[model samples]
Target chain A: MPISLPPPSEEAEAENTLAAIGEFGLIDRVTAGRVQPATTLLGPGDDAAVVAASDGRVVACTDVLVAGVHFRLDWSAPDQIGRKAAAANLADIAAMGAVPTALLVGLACPADTPVETLAGLADGLWAEAGSVGAGVVGGDVASSPTLVLSVTALGSLDGREAVTRAGARPGDVVALAGRVGWAAAGWAVLARGFRSPVAVVAAHRVPEPPYAAGPQAAKAGATAMIDVSDGLLADLGHVSRASGARIDVRSGALEIPARLRDIGRALGVDPLHWLLTGGEDHALAATFPGSPPEGWTEIGVVTDGEPAVLVDGRPYAGGPAGWDHFVR
Target chain B: MPISLPPPSEEAEAENTLAAIGEFGLIDRVTAGRVQPATTLLGPGDDAAVVAASDGRVVACTDVLVAGVHFRLDWSAPDQIGRKAAAANLADIAAMGAVPTALLVGLACPADTPVETLAGLADGLWAEAGSVGAGVVGGDVASSPTLVLSVTALGSLDGREAVTRAGARPGDVVALAGRVGWAAAGWAVLARGFRSPVAVVAAHRVPEPPYAAGPQAAKAGATAMIDVSDGLLADLGHVSRASGARIDVRSGALEIPARLRDIGRALGVDPLHWLLTGGEDHALAATFPGSPPEGWTEIGVVTDGEPAVLVDGRPYAGGPAGWDHFVR
Candidate 1:
């Protein structure tokens, strides 16, 4: 269980609001003493940042997260939210078989938001970026009634062909790296007002994406790859449609962790549903022509058929296999 | 004057809301017929976008615009808002002496928003980017109570060194490119509830930054440079502090536009004040070692003194030189 800290004192709160120090002051506070990697030719404190793209190509993607829609302050700390935002975009770069170089953030929040919260968010962003040898090179901030974080991650392809969804062949083996269903289980636990299973809850707060698996898969001659952000079946559906192939997941292949099984038993639900339909674990899912490299588990296969995702040669019974922003 | 558009019919509104079509549906509609520039190796529908960065370096920047804070739907159309957002970020890239290659957007809005409005915004972003041979490479959409647009622009320096704010030397000439104070005048007209002066209002809605001038200045051996987004003096203050030099603007060199003078006389506010303190015009300000290149007007000189920006060798009587987001 997460230890709930005491609320800040009145004096501390008064002195730490964004409005108290103004935009420039807040910028200085957040960016001060941060070290950037060599890839950042020029970091913040300028009109723009210059990042090295030695291979003559850059991979880029953007992700937006809102307060109530993506996370709640009561459920996760500001740092966790920031890490999640950065991870989501970085995974996209990795999915393209590129190494992350830098990130640019556009943050909007109410003026009265605590400076400490913004600082923590910045720290988390830096820490996560640093993990991949990338830098938070530049950003902009604005005042808004709702908190919104927009992160754009840039990566270097290093002269390799980008692994895309369209490359999956009919005779490819589907494989996955990194955890799945943990975050969804955590969500279920939190929704039921229970936080005792700290592992699941922590997974929900910050994902451990198999970032290295992306480029490794590419080097290992993987044909297609995608970071599973919207459940395994839903994301594979993308590959199926793009490559004009059919994908079928073998139910016997996916190993359900004991922790998740116990939670599912207690909740009177099947853990298989979570394994197949849950999202936000940011696992790397790929199609390889041969046996996948070590660290990747074979879970499915691609074949010449009507473009669709099937489970054991049939459709899954679980209702709605993924999260749709507008629908749910 | 901006033409008053008729409100959408109830049927049209109901049929076009974002929730009605869903996320993937909206993505297909907006990106279907659009053509991407040659710089985009892999466009939308992929996990990430691959953009050419042939110069071995990429310039990047992000800017966020909020519904009520940075823009008002009543004052500007969705297309105009999108154009402004794109232009703001692209201008930052230009200020770094780079040619824009691509853009990634992170848009958050209420689920009830009309798809027509969102399409218009995408069109505007595409139109503005296309003007400079750039493309909208990738983006994300999310649901939120407030509308937020976060745009990240990627650019190529073509092997030229970036003109940063920390390179101005004593005795360097300060030059400017593009209009100053026009957006502020337009903002003032809008604030006063008048819209007949279409030029100013349009300027306020969409800034016309001199994109080519940045590279021109860099090629001409500019020592330092910045974008005039936070008023001339206020931005100059940044350059002054960064370069550790005093900059003195010769007030006579700044020619206040006749239209602005007329509006100023009518509004009982001095045009000079607007020229000195206006923000968001996205003009280029640079310090050159010698006589500035063609299309740039020399308006000030950098000198050895305490780091500060002065007008006519003294601080202007204006209450404050620029905008502070939190302090209004």
Candidate 2:
């Protein structure tokens, strides 16, 4: 027997449009069903959330996404945008070997925006925060011509020392704990008008950073660490310049995920380009005093030389430079 | 001999534009010379800022400012934008009767933005946060077509009860702790193509919230509270609806600064319009059981009736309706 389904509009009925729903109603809908971790003493519903700083210290970071610039409405759902914003900020805290505790969000959009869309965005933020056992503690709402989301993440170190970009030493092994260039390859596939038979599109919409690996790297005595929001070479270059060391990536040892390669082939682009130049993968890259802990892949080595990045002992420049906010 | 002064630009030279300055250098400049309060165990320069929730809890809020919608580039500088953004969020914390401890900022701008512009924004945020003895602990940077700033503030209650908007009772006295309608009058002068007096113009640029007044009210047994970011009647309406009380305002008793009245005269607009309908003034409004604290002025009384607000026992209907995100 066939089962009857509710009409599409009814099944997806929103109480009111954002204009009709108003800010307070939209906020209530967005905050429902979210669980606050123990670290968050007070969560949503108040003016601000209070988070526990157990070690008497906290780490914080923020990132902003603008419609048309960071994401297109046609390409990404509001939920995806919310998750990506939270992930990006959380990754920064992870890069410092800190465990995320709470997040504060700032959103601006036109009044006519659907309340359901805003709710979806809030759900995405809650989902991403849940991944790290955190909560969306507070947020702000305002009217604007376009959609803009600003996220701030707070973290606790659990008494571990913070790993900075300035501490990589000569002879240290460079290792990575997550996928690189996957997001970039996905972007290339979309940009070049190629339909890839893979999840590259999903990767482009929502990046999955190695949240645990950051703290793990810190626990294992990594000298310096950074999240690969910029391209691999550009991000590693930060470590090189800060530590006054040369970083040499060994191409053969680098791991390029099969999905990325599949997309690269479909787009008629070299996967290596994405690996070297694409950013927003949020992979954790670190320099270790000895062999890194299990699950980390060694891709390069720190050498006592000029502050620069090299591929196979030579300066390589063959792809679009990594993400730069102003220098598009 | 009088020394010749170079152009204003020459006095504030930045070593690099935002793009040239890069993210790290810009961050360093934006965070230089600011001191953090004891409640902030850590400040900017890390992935996230750690603040002390001494009462085992914290209050947090966020607000965003868009270049053209919130403030015009010609009318306000980056510094003013920064101050306004911080003030908006801080006021939310104050509405909860909490003491602000730290701030996180997310900035989006074109790559060509001057480094000095960002520095000035940071300076303004620091200036405002400093007024409340708070610090800016973390932030993010991104590229957008226009300037967008998102700020999140974290606050502590010092083991006091949170004064929500749901506690007003019949026969309670309604009081206010800061100036009303100055910002609206200043905005009117600017909109009407008339130059306001310096004080009025400054009020329009940056609102000075009565920071200490919130905690003081909480200490003096305020029944309910809210900040006046959305005009007097509208914000008071929130208290009335939440607490199930009717609030009646005695406009004669309200302290409308003389500077605002003069500016209203110049603009050929009713000063009461500015006082009753103006927003972004960041004043504190609360309901008390009896007499208010030392500096607070009695503005109205709470009554046992349907949730509504009135002026002198009658409904007021003269000014433009209160601020609404979607509706104009």
Candidate 3:
């Protein structure tokens, strides 16, 4: 947990914190030597970057991260925070069955913030953007008391129809891509002072979203899809409301990873709670006509009933508290 | 100066408080009846929106506005703040010679922030986006101690080459497509307690960018282009640095509006300060091969020399300090 790079010496360096280096200098440093894809007609030096959208359509989403609210300096590094911010926005783009192409970021932090921290944040953003073959094109930098990051992701449809939450049909198969409840389990372990594996902690810090599964589901004729940011049951409720179809989850079919089970046991909590009520997993949940595409696990089915989510044909007894921003 | 709308009460209205309405409800209220142009394939109500990029490229940029730092709640209303935020990002898109198609916003405010305030912000955003024939596609909301807004704008190239700052050549005509220093003059008048007019205050709160001028400049064979968020000299300095050429401005050729001159006289400050050092006007500055398009005024010329901007063949001696975010 020590500083990864040597601490800056006041004399060795130019005593240039972010305040001293200033916004323009930091922008130049971050954008230097970065290769923009051919889809980008203009890059970061301009007022805005022009990127190719050959598919004749674009997918867009935005997310904001505030220090002490979405993240903490004591727990997460700047790189992890940046990656998390990008991942959240990218996941939303993926949910719309689009390929991410570009990102725009807005950052606000105190003047005293270390220059290295800002560099690390940029590195993290680029790293995450690289996962989907996208680049950070343009952004604004400003001064604030605490760190705040806001990212907007742009994506292309590649001539595919967008998969929306309202497209699910009755009798469709419900499936999921990527792991679920890992982040919540990881959060529990971190909150309860349990020494889980590094991978679990990393999951909590930066959820690895299923980047390719969305377009793959679209290609395979997915009826509807959404990313699981708010717990599984709560997110399903969105699908049910939008699609006007009842969703019934077969809990017995869930494949709870062994590590999550071990952590749940260690904390004397039920693994099912993590699976049902845990959030920020960034997993892709979709409904298909019959069988799902490869790498998807069957979890439930859509049926004709009131627009509600049920667990094994009964109303879920657990409270509907998932992730409400203003509600306690 | 008092609160314009009635304060929210428990029995006032269903959508009066964000906490009462919830995130999804607020989203529905904001997005209801919004009409997307043909450029958008998929609009709001999904995790992300899909916009058309018919020319195979998109232009993107982002900006952040924090209360007390960027704007004062006591001075500017929520509607003005929203319009300003959208204008700042959209202006960047226009500066890239692209037509804006869509926008994404991230909002963070105190839980006690009235839903009416949020509605006003949305109304302002929609009004500004409507001016450019675009739509607000996706966004995220969270709670914070103060109001913070982040906007990302997307634009289409429409089969034209993107105009970049590096393309200027010696002898190119430096032309301007919008008014300069108006925002700065307005800010001075407001700061000095000289109530000039509502239009002056409106200019300070929300800029009127020349949205059509960028694409028109590109069509007319513009070599390089930029949005003058910073002062003319400083913004042109960016073009000079990128193109590795000297730029000479003829101050006598500048078209200072009579309104600005009146405000300058009222505030007892040099109008040149507003013209040289003032920022946030969001005007279009570009270099043309020959004559600029209609409505563009010639202001300067590109020269062969070290990268620098000069006024009247000499370094400007006025104390025209350009904007720097880190410095107050």
Candidate 4:
């Protein structure tokens, strides 16, 4: 057959790989046609980005997600992985009771990676940031054998004092907002070679962190707060240690979601154990001197004692307390 | 040699690895006994750190350093690698005429990495931040096969307007602060298996960016500025494109340091060529309407022409213009 050429558009799309387009070209492709929020005074392309810090204070945090270590490409799409990475850091800013303003990403991947994959990641990051009125202000990309993303989130306190993990008093009530254990339950289902329970599987793919609830709890006189990225009991243990107080969680108040319970029953497991020890849901947990704000459920109370986390007045027997990246 | 153990201190030191100490333990070891500057409203251990952004706006940027791509462990010590990573991001903030206030790092490495290596990296980061009265405010760590560092730097403009790269005018004089070509020369030397000239090799391992000159040039009325991270000609190309003007460099103005000249002679290469196309020294280059600021050497002028960088009124005829992480 004689040599034939595709249309110009088709040829361009076919040539849109990282090595083909190069670093600058990939950057332009990903950042093109994006809209930044008002908080972003200056966006990408410059040496650095300028962002508004209206309260004279900025809240900042970083999270790293490595392929295979944090997620499997076969399990989640590029956009979902990007959203998860962005959510992980943005939730940290929220956990400090601040309003997110901007994010800076550092991506390292193989040279053969597709431009479309990077664009999808950028799209997901932008979508998540836009949900909180923030922007992806600046980032850098380089070549590597493994794909890794480092996301840094910056936020404004809006002139309010930061609700630190050390502020909970003995009389404060422990409350929870958003979902917990759903992602873990999703992981269990997926590990068992079943994907029918779309609800939990989708949860595993993307966490729906309660971003607004953090500021709500702060405005409602929350003494201490944290993002439940580990397990409920494990994260509560952090609050207990930081506040130098004892916490007793009432297991009956957990109330596992119906979907998780059904999946657990199908998988021959107890949903409550997942609720107590599962992680990656990015839920908001806090201590309130009085009643928690709307959307928060009271689950426990802080008591004057040594720093420890107890379930129903005693330690609960569970498989593991929480997730640790490195084995001891 | 009976089966008697050494002292408890010696035993503990020998067992200090990432896997043995775990994630939280490593965090504690690195953060313990460190003093944060006043700009750090809150430091590590919380979900996020609160930093003082005295100005209404904050300058932020991120840079990624990958092992074997950005630096080789055998060529540079862990501390030097950390400083290089931190300096790369901090210089970007300075390029925008901002004073760095804080850094957040995201590290991914093998589980078998030593705690001592991580501590060395943290020490280097802290030392560099302290030089500018800043702090290592927050960071995250994870396990991966390859080591990757993503550092985000946050800075304040001190109420001055940012000197963006798009502001260069037709009648501007181009100037430079800090050294260029030194790191590239050092890399050449190292590649040739000669480590003698300690000066250049040290420069390659750890760059001394003229951070103070950035805000000084801004105060002295620089029209545009950029961090010379890619190469003098290549980075100036960025200024030309961003500002929509042409820059012509007087090759003789870029004086070849005697040390580099000697090394180049021994290697059968022209040091002037290195001066034009070498990168990674993180020097600051800027444009001024009138006389350049003190400590800045004027080497060229911006003219009304197509966006391009020229050497002696013509294109440079030496080698590739700059470095790119991926091939085109």
Q: Name the top TM-score candidate.
A: 1
| Candidate 2 residue lDDT tens string, B243-316 | 98999999898766777667666667778877777888889999999999999999999999999999889898
Best by lDDT: 1
Candidate 1 vs 2: which has more lDDT: 1
Off by over 4 Å in 1: A1-12, B1-12
| Candidate 2 chain B worst ten-residue window by lDDT | B7-16
**Candidate with more favorable, higher lDDT: 1 or 3:** 1
lDDT of 2 by residue, A97-216 (tens): 888888888888877788867888998999999999998888878777768889888887888888878789999999998888888877776666654544777788899999999899
Candidate number with greatest DockQ = 4
For model 3 chain B, give the 10-residue run with minimal summed lDDT.
Answer: B7-16
lDDT of 3 by residue, B132-250 (tens): 99988888888777678989898888888888888899999999987778788778767777656777777888899999999999999999999888788889999999999999999
Candidates ranked by DockQ: 4, 1, 3, 2
CA lDDT of every candidate: 0.92, 0.82, 0.85, 0.91
Which has the higher DockQ value, candidate number 2 or candidate number 3? Answer: 3
DockQ by candidate, in order: 0.86, 0.49, 0.71, 0.87
Question: Cα-based RMSD of the predictions, in order?
Answer: 2.9, 4.0, 2.9, 3.2
Candidate structures ordered by TM-score, highest first: 1, 4, 3, 2
**Steric collisions counted per model:** 0, 12, 9, 0
List model 1 lDDT by residue over A1-328, tens digit each. 9999999888878778888888899889989999999999999999999999999999999999999988888898889988999999899999988899999999999999999899989988998899999999999999999999999999988889999999899889999999999988998998899875999999899988999999999999999999899898999999999999999999899999999999999998798888888888899899999999999999999999999999999998887888778866
Q: For the second chain of model 3, what is the TM-score against the true structure's chain B? A: 0.93
* Number of colliding residue pairs in model 4: 0
